[model samples]
Target: MPIFEYQCRECKKTFETLVFGNQEVTCPMCKGKNVKKLMSAFSHSSDGKFTSSAGPGCGSCSATSCGPS
Candidate 1:
């Protein structure tokens, strides 16, 4: 099973859950079955340096720029 992030269409809340093969997802807050899978961001480290695939906003926010100048 893989963990996936989802946004509830009914409650407009976000949550993470482990999904099995073809398993239905539901929102934990509202118990809504109508949910949409979100695109998850990832990061990696090389030579003790951390990098994010999100490019900005630390991969968790919608900010246009949040990196060091």
Candidate 2:
């Protein structure tokens, strides 16, 4: 039950899907077999705080900490 993110090289669309065993992955948008797995980041919360391996804030934004500190 491992969920992985992928980016379709043909359409340049990014998406996530559940993968099991040695099954092949296809782009949900264009159904293209030419896809590449992307490196994903993980996050968790404890003591009423949110933290991520991508550091503070969303990776695409400049805000410091996307959750309560």
How well does each candidate superpose onto the true structure, as a TM-score? 0.56, 0.58
Error of 2 at 51 (Å): 18
Give the C-alpha lDDT of model 1.
0.72
**Candidate whose lDDT is highest:** 2
Kindly list the per-residue Cα lDDT of model 2 for residues 1-69, writing each as its tens digit.
Answer: 497878999999987778999889999999999999987523421332223465766655677777456
Relative to the true structure, candidate 1 reaches a TM of: 0.56
lDDT of each: 0.72, 0.75
Off by over 4 Å in 2: 44-69
Question: Each prediction's Cα RMSD?
Answer: 10.2, 9.6
lDDT of 1 by residue, 21-41 (tens): 998998999888999998752
**Candidate 2 colliding pairs:** none
Worst 10 residues of 1 by lDDT: 41-50
